[model samples]
Target: MPDGDRYPLAHRLYPYARSADQDRDAGGPAHHPVIVVGGGPVGLALALDLGLRGTPTLVLDDAEGIGEGSRALCFSKRTLEIADRLGCGAPMVEKGVKWQVGKVFHDTDLLYEFDLLPEAGHKAPAFVNLPQPDAERFLVERIRTAISDGAPIEIRGRNRVTALETSQPARLQVETPDGPYALTADYVVACDGARSPVRKMLDLDFEGRVFEDNFLIADVRMKAEFPTERWFWFAPHFKSGDSALLHKQPDDVWRIDFQLGWDIDRKAELSEDRVRARVDAMLGEGVDYDLVWTSIYTFQCRRMRKFRHGPVLFAGDAAHQVSPFGARGANSGIQDADNLGWKLDLVVRGAAPDSLLDTYAEEREAAADENILASTRSTDFITPKSKASRMFRDATLALAARHPFARAMVNSGRLSMPSIYDSYLSMPDALPDGPPATRPGAPCPDAPLGDGFLLEKLGSKFTLLAIGCAAPETGLAVVACEPTPELTARYLGAAPSALYLIRPDQHVAARWPMADAATVAAAHSHACGATT
Candidate 1:
C-alpha cells in the first residue's frame, strides 16, 4: 500500500535525442514532415497512423514515461476499433475489463439496469475499462516496434516545447536536459493536455461552462467480488444526498467517485483520515482495502472554437475537453487522430489539397459540440445546480423505476460513441434502402471476411468494396465481399449489388448500386474536400 502520488506502476522511460541531424538531410530547417507535441495516447496514435502511411514523424513530450494513476479507465468500442487499426487493439482488449451492463440506483433502491449491446455478432465489445497508463504503454510499445521496422517514427521524451512559431513552417523552441535546440516542422500537431502551451501561444481560448461542484476520485486496491459493471448511485446511504460512481478495474482495483459540494476545504477533504472514513462508510468498516491513489477535480465542459490554427493543429484535450461522466475526452480525441491521420498523410504526400485539413476541424468541432452537450446534461442531472433541476432529476429517477418511458430519460452519462459526419466531408447521396449503419459519412461496419474482419481490410488506404457484384477496376484498393446473411444485414440490406468508396480511415465516403470508374473517382475527389 502506497500514498496517492507514489502508486506502484511501471512505465518505460524514453530517452531524449537531438533530431537536428535527421531533418537536415531532408531539406532546409524543416526536417521532419510532422512534429507531434505531447507523447500521450492521442499524439502517439497520430504519429503511428502517419508512420504506417509511409510518412516520417517526430514526437516530442516533456514527461519521461506514461502518467501515474489510472487517469482515464474507460475505452469505448469506437476507440478500440481505432486502436485495432493502429495495431494495438488486441493487447488492450485482452488486458482490459469488458463490460456492457450498467445499473442506476436511487438511494439504496435499484432503479434500472441497461445493456449497451443487446445483440451479438459484432467484432468489438461495447466498452472496456483499463488503466490509462497501460493503454499509453501499449501505444509506446507499438511505436517502438514500428520504428524498429523502419516506419520513420521517432519519440523524444523530456523534450519540452518552450515557444512555438506558427508560420509557413512551424518552429518550436525545445528545452531538453542536455541543452536547448530549435526544430522546425512542415506541420505541427498539439496533443498536449487541456492547458496547452501551443494553444496559449496561438492566443486561443476554451469557452464553456464549469460546474461548481467538486468530486473526489479514489482508486482502492481490495479483494472484493464486485461484478464487472458500472454502478451509479444518486443519493446513497454512505454519502447521503450525493451522487457516487463505482467501477471495477484490472488487478482487483476499484475506482470510486464521490460528489462533494461547492463549499468544502480542499486540504481537509483530501486528508488520508477523511478518505479512509469515506471508504469505510461506503464499503463497510469490516472490509479491508488500501488507498492506491486519490485526487480532487472540478468538471468543465469546454472546447476551442477551431482545432486548426495555420500550420499547427490541435487534438485530444488540447482541442476539446469534457467532464469524466461520459468518458468523452479521450475517446473523442482518439477519433480526432483517426480522422486527421489520413487527411494529413494525403496532404503531406501532395495527393490532396490543404482544404482537406479544414474538414477535420469542421467535423471534429461538430463532434466536440455534441460531446459537450451530452457531458453538460449528465453533469446537470447528477449535480443539479438549482433546486428546480434537482426536483426534476429526482422525479425522473422515481418514475424511471415504474415507467419504461422514464428509463430513457435517465442520464447517468451518455457514454461516448463515434460521430456521424453527415455535413462535413461525406458526399451527399441517397442510400438505396439498406442498413443505415454503413451509410455515407458513417464508419464502415465491421464484418467477418474470410478468415479476418472487414475493418482489417479497409484502413490505411482508400478501399472500394463491391458487395455481391463485380467491381470496376480503379486505382483504389478493391474488396469484393460475397453476400452472406451477416454481411447483408450489416452492409447490404435489400440491394443485390452495391458499391462503397471507403476512405483511408474506414469511413464510408459514398455508396452506389452500380458505379463506374468515373463515379467512384468523383466521389473520392469530393471526399478529399474538392468543391467540384
Candidate 2:
C-alpha cells in the first residue's frame, strides 16, 4: 500500500482494498488476491482460472473490446488441455480449422509435408489457423458470464495502468474512465504486448537482436483456393531471390507474407498492384482475389532478462517476443498463462512457499528462449537475404524437392515443439523405477476412460491413474483417474501395467510400479509439494 492507495477517494471506492494503514486499521478481506493487467488471451485466461478457483482477481485492459485481426491462430494440444480446464475450449476449437498435414512448396514444386498426428500422437495435429478476433470474443463472453455469476473478479475495460511501483506489496496507479486511482494487491502480473509500457516504465532491459529486413503481410479472400491440407513456402521465385509464405485462414481467406528485401521503400514496393503481381507470379498468370487487410512489420526476437521484479511478474509478450515463425507468438503466451496459473494458485492458498513463484521465470524463460531460437532459425533459412545465405537456402530447398522426409524434417523444425522442463526446480532427476507406465517428465499420452470417455476426460486437476490397480491412499486425496485396459491396450498396443500420475497442468508427474503404497505415496507427496 502507498500514500496514493490511502486517499479518501480510493478508500471510498475500494473500501475493502488493502492499504498501508488498513493493515493497522484492521486488514480487510484480502484485497483482490492478484491484479492482472492486459486482458488478452493470456491475461484473461489467467484471471478466469484464478476466479474459478475462488480467488479474487482484477483484470485491466485499455481496449474497448477483445482483440481483432489475424494474428496467432495455432493452438497446441497442451493449450487445448488448459482451455478445457478453464471451460472454454470447445467454442474456440469449433471456430478454427484443424489440419493433419502441412505441406511446404518451393515455387509450385512440393518440397515436404508433415503429419503431426504421427510425430506426437495428437489426433488433432499441430497448428490450426483462425481469426484471432473470434477466439478473443468467445473468451471475453465466457469471462463476462462468470462475472455475472458472481465470481470474485472485476474486469475494467478502457482502463490503463500508468505507473507501477513494486515495493513491499505490488501497487499500480491506473487511469480509468472516471479518473486516476490506485490499486493494491498481493501480486501483479503484466500480460501486455511487445512494446510493454510496464517493461519500459520499469527500465528493465529487453535484451535481444532485431532483424533488419521487413516483411509485408496481406490477408486476401479469394474465390479460387489452394489445397486445404498444405501451407505454402515459396523460395527464389520469379527472379531467383524472392521468398514468401501463404497460410490458409478461416472463412476462405488466406494470409500471405512476403520477405521483400531490406532496402526498398515499403510505400513504393508494397502497393496493392505490387502485392497482386507477387501473388500472380507464384500462382501462375491469372489468380482472382480481393485483399482484405495488409500491413508491413520488421521482426525482433528479444526477451527480458528477468520476468519478475519483486511482486510484479510478466507473462506472454510482456515477458518476451519472437519472430512470428512457427506461430510461436500467441501459442507460447497461452502456455505462459497456463504455467503461471497453478503456481499462483499454490502460493495464494499457502500450499507452497512464496519461493515457488520463482519457478515461473525459470520455466517460461526457457520456453521463450526456445521460441527466439526457432524463429531466428526459420527466418535465416527461409528469408536469407544475404547473397551467400540465399545461395545456401536455394540449394537446401532444391535438395528437399527430391527428398520427401528431408522436407518433413525442415517443416517439423518450424512447428516449434513444446519445450520440456527436466531441469526445473520442481520435478525429480529421474522417474523412480516403475513397473511399465508413462513416467514423469513425459507428456501424458491420451488414453481412454470407461463409459466412452477417454484419458483426455480428466485434465482439469492433478490425476492419479492406476493402471491395473485401484487408487492408493497417498493422503493427498488426488482424483483417481482409472484407465480403461481395453482402451489403453488399443492405443499403446501393450497390456496396461503400473500407475500414472498427472500434474495439475496435465503433464505426467510420476509413474509408480505395481501400485506400491510407499512409492505411490512418495510420488504423490512430491507432486503436491509435501516433500519438497
Candidate 3:
C-alpha cells in the first residue's frame, strides 16, 4: 500500500491584462497584421518570431499563463536552434537538464545506450528536458523584451476567441474577462492544442489513427542522485505496465510514464492510492518522493489535411498531433512557427505574394506526415498486439543487449530531427558534388566561425554564405568565410569554394560552386517564389 501525492505544482506564470479592443463597440473589428489564438509554446513562438522580424503581431490566449504539469518535456536541438534565432534560447538552455545519452532496458537487463549528438561544434545539445510551461514563459519573456525594444508584440491573456470568420482580413469575436469584442487581422493563426477550438469553430476535418492504450504521465519531485539521462523500459521489472519511460528535468522534477492497456479501470487506475502504488513500485520500497503533477492521456497520431485555410492558418497541435513517443509534439510545433513566421512576414509586407504562405502548408504538412509515421511506428513497437509480433519484439530487445546489428531493430523512439523540406520555393543545386548536409532545401547546419558560430550570423533573413570565395552581389546579406576543416567538411565537400543562397528561414535555397550577379539574382527570384 502507498499514499497519494502530497505535493501539487503551481501553474500560470503570465498575468491576464484586459485589452482596449475588448471594449470596442462601434467600428468594425480592430485590424492588425497578424493574430495568434493560443498562447502555448507554438503561439508564443510564432508571435515572438514575427515581433523580432519587425512585424506587428498579437497573441490571444485563453489562459493567462503556462499550463500546469510538465505537459511536454523534451525540447529537441533544432528547436533550440530555432529558439536561438528568436532571441530566447539562452534562458531555456540555461535552465534545462542537458543530456544526449539514452538507455533502453529489457525487463531488468540493460539493452544498450546511445548518444544522440556524438559530434562537437554545435551550439545546442541533442535535447533538453524542460517543463513546457517554462519554455513558454521564456518565449513570453522574449516577447516582452522585444516590445520594450520597439518590436510591436502584445499579448492579451484570457482573451479567448469565441467565434471567427475567415474573410479577407479574418474577423474574430473575442471574449475577455472584461467583456466580448470583435477584432480582425490580415492573417489568423490557430495554435490551440489538439482539441483546438479554432478547428472546431471552422468545422475542419482533423483525421488520424488513435491508439487504444493510455499513458499516465507522473511528474515527481524527489531528492536523489539520478543522472540526467533518458531511461526506457520494455516490460519493466517493476511490473507496473507493458512499457515505461523515465526522464529527468530541472528543479529535481522527474517524469515517469506507464502505458496502461486499453482494458483497465479508468476510475480505479487514476485513484490516488493506485497511482501512488505504481510510483512506489517503480521507485522500489524506500524512496521518498512527492508527485508534482499527474496526467493521463490516450495519444493519437493525427493532423489536418491542410494547415492553411484561406485567411486563417493552423500551427502546432491545432494542425497536427502525435504520440509523445518522440519529443515531436512541442518540437514540431515550434518548427511550425519557424516555418510560417518569415513566410507570413513576407506576405504581410508585400515582399512575397500570398501564395508564398501556401508553401508553409506544404512544408509543415510534409513534416506532420513524417512525425505521424514515426509516432505510429513507435506506438506499434512499444505495444505489439499479436503474439508472434510480441515474440519478435522481445527477441529483438534481448538481442539488442549484446549484438550491435540487433540494436538497430530496437525502436525505443526515433528522436525528433529537423525536416529537410523539398519545398517548392527551393532552387535545385547546380553543383553535383556539394555537401549533402548543406544541399538545397536543407536547414543550414551550424559551424564554427571566428569567435561565434555560423547560425549566429544567419540572423533571420536571406543571406549568402560564401566559403573560400567572394560572394556575388545579390543585394542580400553576405558572409564570407575562409574554408576551415569544419566548413570544408560541412559545406564544401569535394569543392574548394561554394556560394549558398540561404532563405530567410535559414534553409539553403540553392548552392553553386560559383555564381555571377545574374545567376545570383535568378536564384534569389526563384527562391522567393518569383517566376519570370
Q: Which number leads on lDDT?
A: 3
RMSD of 1: 2.1
Q: Give lDDT tens digits, candidate 2, residues 1-532.
A: 1112111121111112223322333443235569888877888888888787777888877765654346666676656656756777777667667765777777768776667666442333355666666666666777777878887777776678899888757777777656666667788999888878888779886889788787777777776557656465665345322566667777777777777777878886668788777767656677777676667788778899989888889998888888877778877888888778877888888877676677777878888998998888887776665899877777777788887545643532377566565534344423343422344554555543544334455555666666556777765434444445543543223434556666666666665544666866666556555534
State the number of backbone clashes in model 3.
0
Model 3, 331-351: lDDT tens digits are 999999999999899889998
Q: List model 1 lDDT by residue over 1-532, tens digit each.
A: 3744434444546866665543455554545799999988899999999998888898889987887777888999889999999999999999899999999988888889989877665678889999888889889889888988989998888889999999878888888877777788889999999999889988898999888999998899899987999999989878722889999888788889998889999889889898888889899879998898888888799999989988899999999889999899889989999999999999999988998999999989998999999999999999888899989998999999889899888898999978888865787665576678888888887778888888888767889988988788788899998887778888788887788889888888998887888888888888887887
Candidates arranged by lDDT, highest first: 3, 1, 2
Model 2 scores a TM of 0.85
Pairs of colliding residues, candidate 2: none
Query: Runs in model 1 with CA error above 4 Å?
Result: 1-12, 18-30
Q: Candidate 2: where are CA atoms >4 Å away?
A: 1-30, 119-125, 236-241, 283-286, 404-413, 429-438, 452-455, 475-496, 515-525, 528-532
State the weakest 10-residue window (summed lDDT) of model 3. 1-10
Off by over 4 Å in 3: 1-14
In angstroms, give how far residue 174 of model 2 lies from its true place. 0.4
Model 3, position 395, has a per-residue lDDT of 91
TM-score of each: 0.96, 0.85, 0.96
